[model samples]
Target: MFRFLRSLVLPEAACEEANNSSRYENLFKKLDLNEDGRVDIAELHAGLKALGIPLGKDAEEKIFKTGDSNKDGQLDFEEFMQYLKDHEKKMKLAFKSLDKNNDGKIEASEIVQSLKILGINISEQQAEKILKSIDADGTMSVDWNEWRDHFLFNPATDIEEIIRYWKHSTVLDIGDSLTIPDEFTEEEKKSGQWWRQLLSGGVAGAVSRTGTAPLDRLKVMMQVHSSKSNKMNISSGLKQMVKEGGVRSLWRGNGVNVIKIAPETAIKFWAYEQYKKIFANEDGKIGTIERFVSGSLAGATAQTSIYPMEVLKTRLAVGKTGQYSGMFDCAKKIFKREGLKAFYKGYVPNILGIIPYAGIDLAVYEALKTAWLDHYASDSANPGVFVLLGCGTVSSTCGQLASYPLALIRTRMQAQALLEGAPQLNMVGLFQRIIANEGILGLYRGIGPNFMKVLPAVSISYVVYEKMKQNLGLA
Candidate 1:
């Protein structure tokens, strides 16, 4: 009778044990590519890639180092279980230490104190900014729900069961890394998550584009109206826009800009996945170079499919009050006057720009991420959110710098009309004219707003993406 009463109240342990059994079985099958019940670094990477989690080489090596307690250079079943249990305990303890009052939420002051405890000193303002992204309730504090949603949403492991692992022990690791292995353990695949990555990326793109629509429109305006005759600068242009219409005018092209996200992300991902397989060898994994090639081609294909939407977006964004009222209105008129081919006016330059932009962006981001892990991240597994944001902003800025001139030219061609008397300018002709008339500086028109949009845009997108993954249980 006593045991039955206890079991009724404390059923979570048995539930977690069952979950652990299944989770371990799935992970062992997937990570042990050779079916040897042990996971090597290469197989671990391959498995992670399949699960849609990306990681740096240095981070992967570190996980291996930490997990391989016996120093065998591989992780057996027992070793993996121990690693999970250890990390889960650390996470829960971290949360508990942050919640000094023993209340469910970690308040603004508590977060500040907790960061100091971890030796991560930041101003109160910076602390608030970082916490704002994870504060779901708008109560200015992070509750257990918010905390779990933000950091404990790994699909590879049953973080719910991991919570049980934590409840059994209140102790934690203060100096260890919290970076979870981002591999697709066999356990995650059973839930039919093959399509989760593409959907998540699509959602991220939509959120990012919509958030930055005003800046994107400003870019178009600066691109098309940077001449002395127009008397247009960023300040004057924004003032003119608000004068013509209210602040709502800023989002004119956002509708079509948002709609293309799904198909584009889906196609790009599908193409990229296929290309990865094609490039893979007997090991069924491809290197970064092969990944880059696959991504570039996939981007081009997706861009071509929705090229018309981009043209329409540009037109609506730059249109006068009477010219275009909405996305369909602009599209119908452009189709009627300029016909279908006009939608692809700057197709070549746009396509060419993708090569340098993506190449530089990926190369720089990966390089910086690995460097950060190698240098400053020796003690911890996770590099933290701030580091990821910094790397993204820096890499995006570099990419835009390399490809800005080409981007400027493409915008001009798209905004140009297809009238018979207008001079037809190929890319070379356009480059020559801009250099001769406006000098090389003309090619970098409107770069200020573009750069301004990068950091916040990337930061918001990443935060939202992680939250969504957790909320959707796809993390």
Candidate 2:
């Protein structure tokens, strides 16, 4: 994480007082591109790119605004020198804060202790990972020079800012509700940006679900009603839905589906944080296995809390226009006729599905992002919008493929009572029944529409999220 900062600063050691002026002059000459003695925005951008420091537009604008003290929209050598000097001072202060023992070196233990005070508990090993990023000589520690060199050109003024820089991974909502929630820093939480981000995500999710409600409804219908006796392709399935309940009916269950996003996200994030703490080893270490377990447990916790809504969504989607008045009516009818247990009809399979869905989603997304960075990103690791969307879509689809059987079973169980004269079955029984009656392919019913909705859903969610973030001052 901190290693990425290395590219932002001039390669020369800025902390060295000796020959400092000459070093700055040389760097300025390099950035002046045409020897005009001034570094304009274009020159600065190209200079940074040449130096392998690819900053975002906002970051570049901020730099120009701050460093161009003359209000000329450009930087002269003197202004550039002063800017580096001030940046170094800020970096020095940040380094001192981490060197708690006043030993002039930031060790792994120091890193752990400092972060622990900030409510971010990490093991010595995790601290080592952080140190490795900035520890240029593999001394397992960072001295003032190393720290200054690492962050001299970085815009971060404090530890939180550094973390924010490192936390710059793209968070795409690919319309799969089962994917793990994004993590937030303590600073983000305290400043209330975490909630804003969540709100942005929620708004994006609502719009996406609503936009694709018809496809979603058709998926549920196929999952519940498709069998050996009935075949449902995308075209015929959509026609049947329109014929059965008119156009507006396609959004039958979308309201509850959208409504549940807040609580589910809130619970999942809170539970994930708590579970991470609990899963941390004696040294506060959390490895991949621990993280996976924490995420899985947190997901299960969230699903358990808001699971009845899942049933409601399924029921409403599969219901005819006049089958029930609304969400409340559907809930009342289910409780009255089928008892409270009916609300948890497919609880087992739903909970079980979280493991594969979350695991594979995380794995595939990381793999894809890493592959892209390794092959395509020579100067910057940020995988622009399309790359991120492509990775998210592909990863989410893989996860869906892995867990669709369980999802289909869960949907069938949720809608079992609605199937006149059909027998109710437990998770395993339903699996057996589907395999016996409809063949192996029965497990993947409605997968076509489920997949069909991914690209557009992701695109809409991403665009809406970016817009919401901009409006919320998060962009």
Candidate 3:
């Protein structure tokens, strides 16, 4: 009431203070494109676009109506202030609504009920996970202070900083599995700080791959031998591998796997950035379709550049110890015995597989993130760390599932023996042969071990990359 009275009176002190706040003054000037010091509907849309709020016409009309009081069809300085105040009040009311029974604290059930009001149906466990994040006391509840501190004290409310952050990525960026969370200055990048970032990513990748090497080798073994001779369970696969060479055999191909991480990451990340620029609008906004296209192309480029290493890796994974001593030995033998075509035996299937994998992974991640934001973003600007991990895991698993058969085929074609009179198989021929010989299930050979590694691989890779960035003072 007092605010209303003050606005009516148009106090000189408050007006002067607001005018002096430079940040708001600049925003108002930008939005007042006509130099009339008032923001019209078109100008408001322009400003919102610049601020990275990608709302449709209906949402724009709803937002415009809130600030254009007295049906002026435009927002003056006082009206803009009123809009900000009203938004703040709405946030407060939202918090209070969650803190039902006037308890000044929000519990998991309250959160669940609040989301239900928004037509968001989530399990109690999911609700509790959300609550526990903001529940600073570990009491499974958040008091008023916790709520205010967690939600209201955002640096992004400053508008300028928020615009910068939003410009980075409106939706989450699905980086290569080895991505580090860091930003570099132009000068730092010119000085090759990116090399350090790439090295950090390589180190993280090596650690993760080495840590999960056994499961990976197991996956390869299953993919190659699951349907041939005797069915290879994880136990029998391990026993066969150990019997052939020893525990060291499990890491046979890991050298190439670890080595390829650096270039693949560097190329994919660099190509993705370039491709995003090619796809971006004048305002630098990329739609989901553009993202998928750019991501697919980037992935294809990287994979093509390093595919020979992929052939080498598969060969080593299945090679008996005496067959080839090391990476160079394996490459030399494949080139000499089978010719250069051996390196690209399954190139067609590999390319087809990667496009869908990259597209589906990015699409699923964006969908999940958008859903979470639409339904549960009232109390926070960013989703929790666990939410990110869960989204990545599920999205990656879905992508892998979609592309697994092609992947299995590619690996088989890579590791196939070049024997006299053996049939040369293209993708269709291989698919027909596998189905005819081993049934359709043969195409899904190693999916069990592949899936077993997905969650842990994503979790460990992300956690380690984040930690490395933090340690390097880049996060």
Candidate 4:
């Protein structure tokens, strides 16, 4: 872990290779688009675009002022390099603080407590930001290499600083105030069309489902297998499944899971984006509170649409008595026998828990990313493996904390079908059933293992996905 963290704080030979290449010198050549040795607003924005960083008007002015050491409203090679180096230093500091435990690494639990102590309360957007940053492999954690590449060494820090510097300059230019259009232009709206949103959502869902199926299956087994019964642990359950059937038994209801994942992921990302846009400033910047609101909204929306399917998936995965044939069969049977209300058996818990789950997931993602970009100004990719692992661990821990209760409730509701003439357990009914039979503690069953299972799954998934996206230039 310390090695991983170390990587995030340093840079590779190739990354700094740009220095030998006189990358900044080349950038100045490009920015002098008119060969006039001076940059106007258009020229500055074009220069930013050349570097793959688009800036709004306010951000543009700040960059021009900061990089234009001559006060001539233009950037020279020397000035730009200076700006890049300063930006890199700040990013290093943020990542250093993120690795606050001094254990040479970061974990989800560590991040959560750290944020709480830092008085940096998180919201969903912030969580997503953190997750997306550290989740280089998209498994949601920073492996050593990923932590090094992205979190420890990012190009965006320089890019962002340039923009912020310009924004401040622009504000000073226009009556000491920064102005942004209240709504997206027609072109911007077109860029964010519904189809694109749908595609992103679907992809996220598929990714998450594909990554989490094995763990999800194990979790359900742990939940449904009666403690008094012979099956008391993951190993016993695995042994029983393999003994009775093949290894395929472990994937029992994965079919339903795959189908459900696309919509689930789609809804989650879509809702999150919309919520973030709503609560953020016109310029699309967000604070901790805004991030939380967006994340919670996204979580709630996704859970509401897909939770019933989650229940069905769990039912089909468990109860090997040949009760259900497939996802559709399970759904059909549930609807026919228990009525539509049965689909939402754990709606209350599921919906409420989703708020925190989504919120923390997205917020942590953003925070980690911001921290990464701050530290590594030379590399375009985020912190490498170690950073990714740290971010992932932190994100999953928070998600588990906020969602555990709901998970337990949902499990009980779904498990009702495992018994003969499963009870008509709604949210209240399930609560009563658990409390009456096993006392309040029953609601927290398997929490320890659940955390262990979910945190790693989430961390790894985010980290892996991020790495893939960055390689594709998506991040």
Instruction: Note the Cα lDDT for every prediction shown.
Output: 0.63, 0.79, 0.67, 0.55
Over 380-418, each residue of candidate 4 has an lDDT whose tens digit, in order, gives 333454565555456656666666767777777777766
Give the higher-TM-score candidate: 1 or 3. 3
Writing each residue's lDDT as its tens digit, candidate 3 over 63-158 gives 566667888888888877676556556555667878777787888788667655433444566666666656655687867545543432121222
**Maximum-lDDT candidate:** 2
TM-scores for all candidates? Answer: 0.61, 0.75, 0.64, 0.54
Candidate 1 per-residue lDDT over residues 389-434, each given as its tens digit: 6765676678778888888888788887732354768778988988
The candidate with the higher lDDT, 2 or 4, is: 2
Which stretches in model 3 have alpha-carbon errors above 4 Å? Answer: 1-197, 282-285, 418-422
**Deviation in Å, model 2, residue 369 alpha carbon:** 2.0
Give the clashing pairs for model 3: none
Q: What is the lDDT of residue 246 in candidate 1?
A: 77
Distance (Å) between predicted and true CA of 156, model 3? 8.0
lDDT of 2 by residue, 2-40 (tens): 354434444555255647788678778878999989999
**Backbone clash count, each prediction separately:** 3, 0, 0, 97
Pick out the ten consecutive residues of candidate 4 with the lowest summed lDDT: 168-177
What lDDT score is found at residue 303 in candidate 4? 68
CA RMSD of all predictions: 17.0, 6.7, 14.2, 14.6
Query: Which RMSD does model 4 reach against the true structure?
Result: 14.6
Q: Total backbone clashes of model 3?
A: 0
